[model samples]
Target chain A: MPIARGYAATDASKPLTPFTFERRNPNPDDVVIDIKFAGICHSDIHTVRNEWKNAVYPIVPGHEIAGIVSAVGSDVTKFKVGDRVGVGCFVDSCIGCAERDLDREQYMPGLAGTYNDFEADRKTRTQGGYSDSIVVREGYVMSIPDNLPLDASAPLLCAGITLYSPLRHWNAGPGKKVAIVGMGGLGHMGVKLGAAMGADITVLSQSLSKKEDGLKLGAKEYYATNDPETFTKLAGTFDLIICTVSAEIDWNAYLGLLKVDGSFVVVGAPENPIPVHAFSIIPGRKSISGSMIGSIKETQEMLDFCGEHNIVSEIEKINIQQVNEAYERVLKSDVRYRFVIDIASLAA
Target chain B: MPIARGYAATDASKPLTPFTFERRNPNPDDVVIDIKFAGICHSDIHTVRNEWKNAVYPIVPGHEIAGIVSAVGSDVTKFKVGDRVGVGCFVDSCIGCAERDLDREQYMPGLAGTYNDFEADRKTRTQGGYSDSIVVREGYVMSIPDNLPLDASAPLLCAGITLYSPLRHWNAGPGKKVAIVGMGGLGHMGVKLGAAMGADITVLSQSLSKKEDGLKLGAKEYYATNDPETFTKLAGTFDLIICTVSAEIDWNAYLGLLKVDGSFVVVGAPENPIPVHAFSIIPGRKSISGSMIGSIKETQEMLDFCGEHNIVSEIEKINIQQVNEAYERVLKSDVRYRFVIDIASLAA
Candidate 1:
């Protein structure tokens, strides 16, 4: 057994506190990683508080992980000791199912989450990268480019792939008009990645407060969604709009912003069902879709794409002691973008 | 002026009565059609009863029209004076707009409905195919294949194209698993067309009462939506699901039946907005979209396809005098599939 030190929530009502747990021994195809930086995703907050209603007790919630390979099992060929690496939302999935494709395993059945889930054996608990050390299958481990720092690059594991997958899937390259709704952690990355892909990017934020930041982050235009004229002026404009907000907004109005045959994809989830009128998508033959995080292969490709574009998330670094306070600020949308935890602080 | 006689709704509350209206004088680009058969669509009932709230009174409600060419303008090169023809949902659109494609004019703005709408002049009211005669632009007329009879082929102008457009758009063909979500007029056509396209078809109706009819029409399987087990048994089973019923049902439940990267397309309109949970699509990267009727170009393709396959709507022919009673039966889903009115009875 490998002892791992981390912070975890023992119950839904309590804040995460220092805890120590034993990690499973490395399997033949596993790679042991010395977790360097962990990004505090909104999903982490949701899990710690059991907001999604599926959280397991003593859950160490982190999925956006970036680190260095400390050890590798005998059969692990893709990763070696001292290599920079990363892990995302899942650690394992059904490997041999006929429906499982190498490039789309994230959407398949039997996906084991990095935390709050059981491993393939269905007996061993799988903990995430909030810990000081994590062991993941070599196949799920991604390589982080040397130029992108681990702290800022941590959010790319989850936030980057969430936006990048839909953008690439919908063909958001040259001559494409893409809109990224919301100006938060996931959205700011969409602006950067979409603009890097040669797409004309626009930010539809609740207010113009982040217009300067949005424009600086490679957006060609920024509009305040609070104004009614925003809807009227931009009706039937975008080729694709990736909504990154979890708030209950008028989905029909956004559907109106797409041109004929355009798509509106949702990456963030609201608490309740959204009301959508058929006429919203009927006249233009538009679509409303949802995308989760990308597959392991695509996530690595995204990392390589970021390397070529010199892209990394705009992150605020904090020590492990300040994570509980960071959750409150995140709820208020007070962070500039993402908050990354320095794992070395855990050892101290 | 050309005199035309048809049954028209004088007001929202009263039954349709015999009314005489003037057809526009032939333009240099017009083709005059002598109406022979007209298919009664649900939209006609909705418009005549003012259910959609946009009906112009004295509306002549028919768009699924089959007829013969009584006259052709000097510039008409596609049709002769005695050619078999059909007129669908719209007779004119913004023909020269930048967004208008020759293959997708039905989704564009400035579309002139075949009935209850104005022509390009914006002053002359466009009455539809429920009349003794109709004057239409040569560009909007489609040639009916010689093998199909005028009455049985009438619904292809509307119902056939409505199902055909989305099936082709979503790539429902060989090796594809498709489910038609209703077994009414539009869905029965979907079953035949999807099966013709070499895709395996299934029917998900409210009850298994029509299971025998579904199988006879080429469905591989039939499931009753009213049975809860159907949802569980067919979860993640379809590659494409085309919903043709306008009644509000559990859209989320239907969405769960799609495979990864699958699409759920809507051709029917419900009066109110439907509530959809984000989880319904996010997990599978699924989509919910809408498609109206096809353009004149694709409508011609559908007619040619139907001709080759020997396909026609399963219709119950009724005299024009019985249309008011037919509307009541349609509201109750009592008709076998469609009711084609004998336009010769209009001249009696």
Candidate 2:
């Protein structure tokens, strides 16, 4: 067993505090990573506060992890000591792996989550990426591009891939008119990746507050969705609308902007059910859909695409001690984009 | 003006009665068809009863018509007086007379429906195929293949194209598992077309009453949605589900059957709104979409494919006088598949 340190919330309402933990020795296909950076995902906040009712406390919540490989078991072919690697929302999946068929192995009856989920033995609790070190299967760990800085690449495991998966799956490319709703962590990445994929990108935000930032991220157009004229002007315009905001927008208003057979892909999963009118999808033969993060193969593709395109999140690096304050700022939509933690501060 | 004979529903609740009307004189780009057979679509029922609330009565409700061209304008190069031409759904679209992105054009804001809709001028209300003669622009008229008899090809216009559009759009082919919901006019066609497209087909009906016919139409599996075990045995099994039934099914239950990012395309639209939990779509990355009839290009493609495949809807051919009884039978789900009206019966 290896002693490790991380910031954890012992109770739902409490701020994170320094906690000690243990990591099991690496198996033949496992690699031990010394965590350098961890991204503060919205899901971490939700789980830490028990907002989603699945938080098991003394929870060290972080899934977007980037680090240096410190050790590898004999059979670990993908990584060697000193290599940079990253872990995303999941750590271990079904043994069958059942490569890349939506609900087949991982998320269906035979899946595992990064934190608060039982390991393959169904007895060991799987600790997440916020810790100083983690032992993960080599197949679950990805090679982080050398050109991409570790801190900047942390959120790619979550925010970057969440947007990338849908855009790629929906065929966003040259001549495709794509819209990204909201301009926060996920939205900004959507704009950047969409542009990188050669799509004509548009940003639809609450006000024009993020208009300048949107254009800087390669958006061809920006509009305030709050304006009534926005709906009128953009009616039947977008071929695909990727919504990344967690809160509910007026869905009918969004549905009105879809062209014939257009899709509204929801990455913004709110706790409440979305009250959707069937009529919204009827007239123009539109679609309402939702997408989760990418598969292991797709994540690699996203990483390669990012490496080639020089794309990374506009991250605000914070010390481990500022995590609680950062959470409040994140809730208020005050962060520039993502807040990544410098994991060394956990030792202090 | 050419004095034409047809059937019109004078009021919302009354059965359609024999009536006399006038079609416009053939324009330079027009072809006049001597209507032979008209297939009854669910939309025809909706229009005659004003159930969609947008229907204009004394409406002539028909869009699937197969006939011989009786007259052609001097500049109409596509069709001659004796050619077999068929008219379906929308006869005129905003991006008129062009096949480039015709699906986009079909639902364009100002696109006109074949019947019970105001024409391009916004003054003349266009009648439809349930008549003795129809003068249509050459662009909207398709050539029916010689192998597919006119009686059988009538339903091919509406029912055939509706299923073909979604099946092809969703990539239903060899190695793909496709499910057709319901066994009515559209559903039967879906099964035959999906099977002919080289996909493994399944039928989800209310009961096993249509099981034999479903198998004969190319279904590899037949299950009743009402049976509790149907979901358990086939959960996460299908790649594409073309929902031909308009009434709401258990969305999450059906969603559970999709194999990650799989699509359920709704061809039959229900009147009421469906309550969908965002979590249903989010977790599996599944989609629920609606499709209207196909474009003229795809309709021709569908007819050609049907002609080569020797595919047609199982129909009960009736004189125009039996349309009232046919509607009652359709409402009861008594018709085997579709009802085709012999237009010459109107002159009796």
Highest DockQ against the true fold, candidate: 1
RMSD of each: 0.9, 2.5
lDDT against the true structure, per candidate, is 0.93, 0.87
Deviation in Å, model 2, residue A241 alpha carbon: 1.5
lDDT of 1 by residue, A1-348 (tens): 999999999998888899899998999999999999999999999988988899878899899999999999999999889999999999999987764654788898889999999998988888887889999999889999999888899999999999999999999999999999999999999999999999999999999999999999999999999998999999999999999999989888899999999999999999888787999989989999999999888999999999999999999999998899999999999998999999999978
Q: What TM-score, to 2 decimals, does candidate 2 have?
A: 0.94
Show model 1 residue runs off by greater than 4 Å.
Answer: none
TM-score of each: 0.99, 0.94
Give the Å error, residue A150, model 2. 2.3
lDDT score for candidate 1 against the true structure? 0.93
- Residue B167 C-alpha lDDT in model 1: 95
Which regions of candidate 2 are displaced past 4 Å? A95-97, A100-109, A275-279, A282-285, B95-104
